[model samples]
Target chain A: MQGVRIQQEMSLFEKLNILSDAAKYDVACTSSGTDRRGDGKGIGNCKAAGICHSFSADGRCISLLKILFTNECIFDCKYCINRASNDVKRASFTPDEVCRLTIEFYRRNYIEGLFLSSGVLKSPDYTMRLIYETLWKLRQEYHFQGYIHVKAIPGASQELIQMTGFLADRMSVNLELPTAESLRKLAPHKSRKNILGPMRLVQNKREENKQEIAVYKHAPRFVPAGQSTQMIIGATPESDYQIIHVAESLYQKFQLKRVFYSAFIHVNEDASLPARTDEGPPLLREHRLYQADWLLRYYHFSASELLSEKQPNFNVLLDPKCDWAIRHLEWFPVEVNRADYQVLLRVPGIGYTSARRIVKARKFGSLDFEDLRKMGVVLKRALYFITCKGRMMYPVKMEQDYILRNILDPREKLPGGLGEMGYRQLSLFDDVNFREVKAE
Target chain B: MLKRRFICTDTTIGILSAIYDAWKMDRTDTEAGIPLWGTVQHEMFCEYYEVEENERKAGAVRKLIRERLGKQAYSDISYAILSKDEDKGTAILQTMVAARELADSHRIMEHLSHPAVRRVFEMSRNVGREAHYWEEFLRFREMKPKILYAEITPQNQVLPAIADHFADRFPLEDFVIYDKNHASYMIHPRQKKWMFMTDHEQKWEAAKELSEEEEAWCTLWKGFRKSISIKDRENKKLQTQNMPLRYRGDMPEYGKS
Candidate 1:
């Protein structure tokens, strides 16, 4: 193709354009929790609170120099834009080129670190070696102490993955599809065992390195921020229940710091993939899953509690917490003054910060609804579920549907794009600026 | 109930020394005996006692705070000093006084019921949040060889909090982050220590014309930003929520790319 042929003689910027666009669908650009400061002789350092240098049009935070090492692949994954079968432009960055780009980009303070991933080229070994060389050069030669999150080629040798782990702050092996069956159907070259194998290796290496550092005090860190993995959502017909459980298992088994979910975009024409629709890539579903995941990680919620085979999906109208609260009505009207911290956390409006604030504020005096509002509780949502001094904010019934209807008030303003006339086509009246006057 | 107002400079040390002078003035007979106020304008109907900044007195109060409370409280006080709140100096003093009587006073950070304690805590958290955001939002342009310059207009005075992070991240380069609102700047010279210059006479120079290579990189960055978005998920509302419009002016991706 013309695009493919022109790419062979392309400039570095052109290559970057193609490769970064190819890589964007993966959706794991976080650069958090790496505390490796520059060793005075180095060029950069990583702080715990990751810097988001900019935001893309998609509203995703750009924290790293997220680019694929190359777009030349050996396998044909149906969902991937960079699949070998696709007649798209291909480009690869040399080790020195990647180093130079990272150093220069970092010097201008454009990025916090580099997130290097790639499609397989020639062999997994060769592709991995090139990545390792780039990272090794960046760390050893350039002395770039900034965060580096690299993707581990699933079937790459244990030695190559281990060597690269020492040079990176974080490593990820994309568990692209959740289940083994879906992975087989979509990515024929990728296997669940091959992916999990390297993930296990990284986990073990981190464990061993932790012990080594406990004794030696300088036994080079292994993925100091720990490994994170991403799973493609809305693909292969996996239920929300299944996806949530898989993420939980990954956290429990692999010790992952994060599990990113990418809403499946129908990029290619394949019989196995879902039909393309104007409704877009299950963005709302992906949002719900992230909310549920937050509950799992921070709110001490179990996946079973959030979802079950009986009720497989979350309520699209209400948040996961509200839905849960509606289902388990007996848990409602939790006395704010009497409930424990964990109980307070389960209340809809009281988040981690406000729950703690409530507990601390109650120490000096008894807190009313007004006090709860002052302490940052979302009273509109929390009113039905919480009580101040054993009195509900309103004389409300304990019926589920009633409470749900009350919570989803007709007058209550919904988040943008979820309200009336949300997806309306352009109309003559849409541009009119009508001013409503109040009657005296 | 005429209050004895201690007028002091705006720095943390100035306020602390004022607190020290008030504590030693023996004006306990009056109902609202002594209150610390910064030189900055404030509504007042009280006798003003000008307290010159005494490092010795400030040091004594600092030691008293450390002895009664702990190191963490001292740091909280330092963070509170960076708050733009007009009542910050008084809030820190009252918080210190209240903290002495509280049980496990070191953890007096959790005592949000006391108005002063809450104010100090909220002020510190606000400053800390701004510093955290600046760590992420501050954009640097190479003005000269090995010299990187960034400009920030943060809500609070946060240059002092974020300077070490950049210096540590780029130890071999000279970087300066100017806080336009506070009229202060932090400079980190190559391989040398980082330092803060407050109320300096230097006016900010316009951002230099980007080098050809820098221009190319900016173009590439903008391209990456444009190419990354799934057009169907273009939520300008959400984008503005995450990366505010105020921060977009300096960001290359949002600039004339």
Candidate 2:
């Protein structure tokens, strides 16, 4: 192909542009979940709360140097921009080139670490071996102790995956689509079983490594930052209920660290995919899913509690937490001075940190609304649901419509596209902006 | 009762020395206050005193807080003293006095209902957050002779707060982080301990000379940053919200080279 022929003359600048542009669709750019000192010998360290070195125009945190090792794929995934059938510019970085870039970038403090993903080159095993070699060089030869997040090719052998896992801080295998049926329609080359196989392997190996480290204090850790996965939303017709249920089970069954939801952006057109429109990606639905995902991980909530088969979608007008609080109004007016930490968490505006702070601070004295606000509780939202010293922040009735209308004020900030929808009741006949507000 | 107000310079040792004198007075919370020098608002029926700032009195107060109120509170007070707030000194003094009423003096941080303790908590949080921001946004450039030089215009005195982090991360490299706001430098020499220097007379003209390879690497980084952004999902509001415009001045990707 012309792209292959031009690769020989491409400069490092051209290669970086093409590769990072190709890898921009990836949603996981975090450098969190690992804490390691530099050992006073290497070049970098990991902070538990990851540092965002910069942010891109898309507003995503540029924590790592997110790039594909090569844009040469054998698979013909219809949704992928770099699919084999596509005629995009293809470039591959040699192992030495990647190491040089990582070490130089580390010295400049431009990035936290490296996020090395790749397109399948020739075969899954071949691509996995290249990734392994690149990581091995970065860790041993370069003495780079910074964070590394590598992708484990779905069909790669178990031995290669385990070898790469030891050197990486995090590993991931993309679930592609939420369900297996949708996976077959969109990504014919990727099977659900093939994707879940490596995920299960990493989990089991991590468990075993934990026991090993318990016995041997300095035993080398395997995937010290744990593993995460991402799935495309709005590409298929999966409901938010189905999507989060799948995420819940993955967190429970596979013990994954994070399950990222990427709003499907139209990069390629195919017969089975949704028709392209100028509405752009479903960012509002993606935002709601992330909010609900945080609810599952930190707020001790279940997928069933947030959504169900009857209401299998998030409200475009309200967030999942506020929606839940509105539906379950019987649990309102929770006494701030008396509520348990879990109960305070269930309040609309109180977060995990604020809840903990409230629980700790109330031990000294009973908290009022001012103290609650000082402790980081959003009183404009929490006032409707909480009471301090047996009196609410405002003298308002506790009714569903009244509270919902007040909470959904036009001034309250909504995610990007949803701001134009206004505060009107959802009428069955009014589908004027249906394409924009469509919940995935 | 006449209120006794002790005044000192705006440094960690200065604040601690004021606290030492305040504690020695053993006056009630309403009768004693510690304010920074040049920021004290004189009031009637108030006896103003200039504190004799020294390392010995500061050491005594540091030891007292660390031993009585615990290391966590001591660290909080230390960070609070680094803040630019004029009332931080009085807050730390009142917070230390409040700890005496607690059954477990070490748990004074949990007494957030007290206004002075809460003020200390807020100031420490603000200083620590600014320090963390410096850790993320400070960009190092390769200067002549292979020295890594970075310049930051931080709002607080965060050079001391972030010195250990950068020193530990780049132990083998010689780097200098100059704080433009504080007129100081944190110099970490190769394989040696990091030290703070406040020599305003030192010429910095030579440090501006960049290495030959610096521009090339910066161009590559700028290109990578531009391409990695998905144009269809561009949201300048969110971008500015995540990385504020103030931090963009030192970053090469945001530079106009």
Candidate 3:
């Protein structure tokens, strides 16, 4: 372990070059998830966009230098660049190098904080120990009370993982593959057990911290941004049902902050890897996963109700809600003013924001189309499902055909629509000119 | 594409008053005409009117916004109009009119909920959210001139909100938050004015060596980072979604450690 005094050896410039270059591939540090506040001391705070910088060529936001400790590896994960056998340019940072770079970049305001991940340097614990040392120095010696999002190395020791919670604002353990069997095939060195062991430990610790925070006024700090994990969508053959099922379990069991869906991009062309070339990253599928994920997280929808092993994947044309609403048409035609909160949440057009608004405004008076619009209900989706004052806006007749035409027919998605990529690609004038290009 | 111009010396208030006066003069039977601030070609059909800087008029306009649209609405809409949204001008006007018509404590919120109002509110609210988050995410270290500097290239105009937010949140500090896309500053929290600083003036170098103390602090910071994550439920997309790469340079959460 490089002592804290290693800062004198490398200038902040050199540290930034090495660490930021190292951090470029992590694909973590999406900062909008957390809600950390400004204490009386310290100069910086968090923003929803978390101070955007630039986007990578693949249309993903480069919010942080998503990089790793070193490209050297002991494992041969088929999809990974640093897979032990690959001959890529390798780099590793002493704990001191990482600490120096972080402080330097942080000082220059070129970055938010570090998203430090590693490629099994010697072992998970060995690499994690260096990371732990780096963070310890940043927080204690520099008194840097800013955002820090670190990665929890799978199979790392419990105390190492625990120390991360105290030091960083957010941390993540990536679920690279949705299914373990597929993971075994694609990433042999990485096992389901090694990946999830530290995850479970972190889950338990955060739970304990949450309980303490709830019961007592104060508790020893945990990740204020909380713990999150990433899953590569469309890489393996796992269905959306399988993805959601795993996600729901994670949320319930581990209390994860978020479950990010990275539509797998075949960064390297490895034949052994389940080739993602034909489909690229299933951007549309990934978009649907996010919609379904949002439903699970905010709309209180259950995995069973949304999909099953029989019907594994979500339909690309229709959204999760519309698809569900169409299947269970018996639940439709609920009067806006009368439906219960959970029932209201099930409506196709109504979102958490709109549903809450509907609840508030309906208390004032019965809602009309105008009122629904005022209440932030996305009428395009809502109109097919709900009735105002017990009367459907359109003639109430054969429901399946109508719902299918409106919601399902546009699976490939019509032009000028609000579907993820379609809407953003609106005007030719709106190329890179429109900067909020993050697909998530 | 001839249009009126006003280089109001006062802040957003003066500009808003000029907008109000221009809007009043351009009323037709059905559609209202507004000279969107910077896009005019100064053609023959469109008359070019210049408005002088007037604090009294600015005050009068501020009073009207408060009386009609509530107090916070002025800043909210002014910031919205000055924001980088393509539809900023019309949105500000529509929200302003909508707020005036509603004229209650929750009027701005009511407009925030209104579809047309929400369109603008969402734009500005998003801008505001990013700016606010940038404050927390931004990591700044010391440089020459005693200025704590950070740079960003956001999708929206966020300096004002970010600057104003940093002031309340990080009071008694001297900093310059710059947007690289558009050369502007969330200027001086201490000075309380929006200004611009060129790279030459700032003389800031991005990468440098940290002090021994700083290195120690970074390691501790990473140690704290190590503890926060529960590995089981990680979602890379969600992490990327919040802390988009575009905003990373300024985020403290993802800086080096």
Candidate 2 lDDT over residue span A1-440, tens digit each: 54435336789999999999989898999899999998998899999899999888989999999999999999999999999999898999999999999999989999999999999999999999999999999999999999999999999999999999999999999998999999999999999999999999999999999999999999999999999999999999999999999999999999999999999999998998899988989999999999999999999999999999999999988899999999999998899999988989999999999999999889898999999888889998999999999999889889999999898767767888775566578788975776777864
| True lDDT of residue A272, candidate 2 | 86
How accurate locally, in lDDT, is each candidate? 0.82, 0.91, 0.65
* Model 1 interface DockQ: 0.66
Error of 3 at A31 (Å): 1.3
TM-score of chain A of each: 0.91, 0.95, 0.82
Q: Order candidates by DockQ, high to low.
A: 2, 1, 3
Q: Taking the tens digit of each residue's C-alpha lDDT, what string does model 1 give over B138-251?
A: 778776454678888987888777877787778888778888887888888788888777666655453566555667777777777788777767777777888887766677
True contacts kept of each: 0.78, 0.82, 0.15
B146-227, model 2: which lDDT tens digit per residue? 9999999988899999998899899989999998888888889998998877756574443778999999999999999999
Error of 2 at A257 (Å): 0.9
Evaluation by lDDT, superior candidate among 1 and 3 = 1
DockQ of 3: 0.11
TM-score of each: 0.91, 0.96, 0.67
Model 2: CA > 4 A from native: A1-7, A422-440, B27-30, B200-206
Q: On residues A125-146, what C-alpha lDDT tens digit does candidate 1 reach at each position?
A: 9999999999999988988888
Q: Which model is ahead, 1 or 3, in terms of TM-score?
A: 1
The per-residue C-alpha lDDT of model 2 at residue B221 equals: 91
Cα deviation at A162, candidate 2, in Å, is: 0.7
A1-440: candidate 3 lDDT, tens digit per residue:
85242224544344444444444445565766555555545434565445544333334444453456665668787776567777655556666666665555555444566677877878888888888888888777766665778898887888888987798778888888888898888888778988788788777777788889898866767887778888887667788898999999998988887888866656556775665444345667778888888988999888998998789888766788888998998888788888998989999878887777677656544778877775568777777888989887777564788668765443544321133454444566645743565653
Better of 1 and 2 by TM-score: 2
